[model samples]
Target: MKKEESFSLEKGEANQELDDDGKPTRTGTWLSASAHIITAVVGSGVLSLTWCLAQLGWVVGTSFLVVFAAISWFTCILLTDCYRSHVTGSRNYNYMQAVKTNLGGRKYKLCGIAQYGTLVGVSIGYTITSSISMAAIKRSNCFYKYGHDKECHTLNTPYMLIFAFIEIIMSQIPDFHKLSFISIIATIMSFAYSSIGIGLSIAKIAGGAYPRTSIGLPTRTDISNMDKMWNIFCAIGDMAFAYSFCAVLIEIQDTLKSSPPENKVMKTATTIGISATTSFYMLCGLLGYAAFGNDAPGNYLTGFGYYDPFWLVDIGNLCIVIHLLGAYQVMVQPFFAFVENWSHRKWPESGIVNKDYTVGCFRINSFRLVWRSTYVILATLVAMIFPFFNEFLALIGSMTFWPLTVYFPIEMYISQVKLRRNSFTWIWLKALSFVCLLVSLLAAVGSIRGLVVSVETFKVFRSMS
Candidate 1:
């Protein structure tokens, strides 16, 4: 068989003319793009919102959610235009490419470290979250078999390995454009778990046995003033993490067809996706906090809010596992593509790195097979080593939120449109960026402190009940 025929990324596209970037022709619509966005944006982070909301109280927590969503939406609009270069009118295949094109120099390198690092961190976070959901399912059943107060704890290592094994196989998917079905299913699972959480919260609130409520900060007497400050910062970090998904916006947009123009389609998709995500965030955060007040658990579903409805809780957790399976891929594919593509360029003649074998209908690359599997295993190891869910989420969110989500997009947009320096729009954008930088710094500090406390009290691979 011919080399081209044997190593094609997608079948049936060998005969078609390549896209402007010499890749397969894109067939994604706004709807498909929306699905990908929803899958990537609305993820396991949603489960932690109620705890964050509880810490921030009703006023600040709710306000932060709205503010973060608006910021993410606006910056995403800026990023969509950067998908295609202004001077060359050529497509920027990924976020790094978009940054390099518009904001070249050392900033391009900085964007890469931040973007890819965030992607890898997110993958590890997902692995940890999926494993927790799996364990939660087992514990939920144990509680049903025995009682809610019974000692029923499960180990997360085996579940993390199971999740890793599944990802190793799914990571064989050739390209981002080929992930529509997975994204669609993951998006459905996201909605399913989110809806379940909201429903459970509503039921709890309606039962009229909820905990003490608060209006400003959490009113718990056990929490010290410094602890309250850190919690508030960490909560803001969680909200920031919940809303920001710009890292993958360009990659998702790349899958869209060019007839209606990719930028316009992506803008519409961003609006719709962010709108849907924010609605879920608001519903879950508000209702969950209302349900449990200051004592809301970090994970609404797996945190044992309702043990009576054991079956429903199991289903909700299963949905989370399934959803993370896909969300992991959606977020990590770009990182995979970056490393694999670079390896192919660097060692064009190395068979192990460049060779692709035919496995039925799919073309599997040797480098992809080895490296992708290795990456998943390493991520699983990290997940097991430090499975601090809320703290980990906040840390990753705080680290990447400013540069990747806010600064790069804003700077790239300014460069693309040639906004005059110190003008009203320039001043406004700079001020926004500056404020977000502070938020990110504070969130990072809070997350680090939380992680420190967690590490001091916990051992490696500690199982939870």
Candidate 2:
């Protein structure tokens, strides 16, 4: 029994080093955790928030953001409870293990699928968006110099390949917890682009460039109300995308200061992260809507066109590429953990674990070089082929939001924690989880419809132009 336990522990978590006080040394503060959450939540999704606003108009869109924020906060609280219950002062290396610990292997399979798929989707989205943002800058310059019929040479394919090479090299880091510095930079880059977007919108409004109006809605009563409602759900998916950090929560919690990563710290970090991100989302969404009104583009910054002050627009897009570079790392590192954990179990005789101090450990090892590079390259090729950015975000959000963000956390809490059976609180919680599942179903339908529309509308094999 003792030998079996030792093997299981080693497979479950590689890093179990004790501190000088004979206690498990925790590494991150509430602030760093919050920063990591903020970094995850506030990425390229913010770029399409104006398009969300355009879908639902100002009143409905802003309300949806606030609602999702509240839901997300509550989800975090549930996660903290699960961590305390399942972990109970022990080390938990990843979210999958946490789920399997509480809910067993059957549930763990679903959670693992959703978590890994969601992270891959996010990384692919960033790759596609980063290259598109870069190409937008080049297109802007081409249009400026060559007028409306500019045959710009810069397509997303080459840039996607370039970013894949860069990201694959950076992803050679073995430990997910050590990504805190990169997450910090990602958080700052998020703010940089969001603030710049807000500034530009404000400048446009103050300069009498923006006229008050709403875009993407029909004025004609002849159009079906179904169309409007579908758009509303699509917008909800966008807001959900903007607010999703649950997929990365357990990985982020790996750094919490309190052993077992206590509730107060997680709650404080959750509140801070959610509040700040919501504020930024609302600001950018509202201002961008006000600035562009009914004519808002799907991506506000790129859609700004190569008019006057083109340099500022170009800089904003460049910052997005930089931000996505960091955000891509933040999102994919957890996936890397999942991969490495599985690989180490398969080849236990080999040293396939994190070597923090070894110089060669950080270099491009054959396993990492092959697996990670292949992962990035596959994502890049997919993005290059099917470049439907906003719809893809919504689709990924709808697929995972309920399972990862709402359902899994709450169900695991009920399963693991000592909740009174048949009590009102427990009943209410069950009902809420059921409702979230229904919501997820609705969002999935909307996502499929949105995806179909996007595919039909977007230029496939676009570089073939």
Q: Which digits, one per residue and each the tens of the lDDT, describe model 1 over residues 1-465?
A: 556653342332434456545666788889999999999988877989999988988898888898998999999998999988889878899999998899886888999899999999899989988988999998888888887788787888889999999999999997798899999999999999999988988887788856876888777789789998998888888888786578889999988877678899999999999999999989998998888788888888886523668888889999999999999999999999999889989998899997789989989888898899999999999998888888889988997789988999999988978999999999999999999999999999999999899888887877464
Quote each prediction's TM-score.
0.95, 0.88
For model 2, state the Cα shift of residue 280 in Å: 0.3
Q: lDDT (CA) for every model shown?
A: 0.87, 0.76
Output the lDDT of residue 421, model 2: 90
RMSD (Å) of each candidate, 1 decimal: 4.0, 5.0
lDDT of 2 by residue, 258-329 (tens): 543356777888889999988998899999999887557778888765555777778888888877887888
Error of 2 at 406 (Å): 0.5
Model 1 regions lying over 4 Å from their true place: 1-17
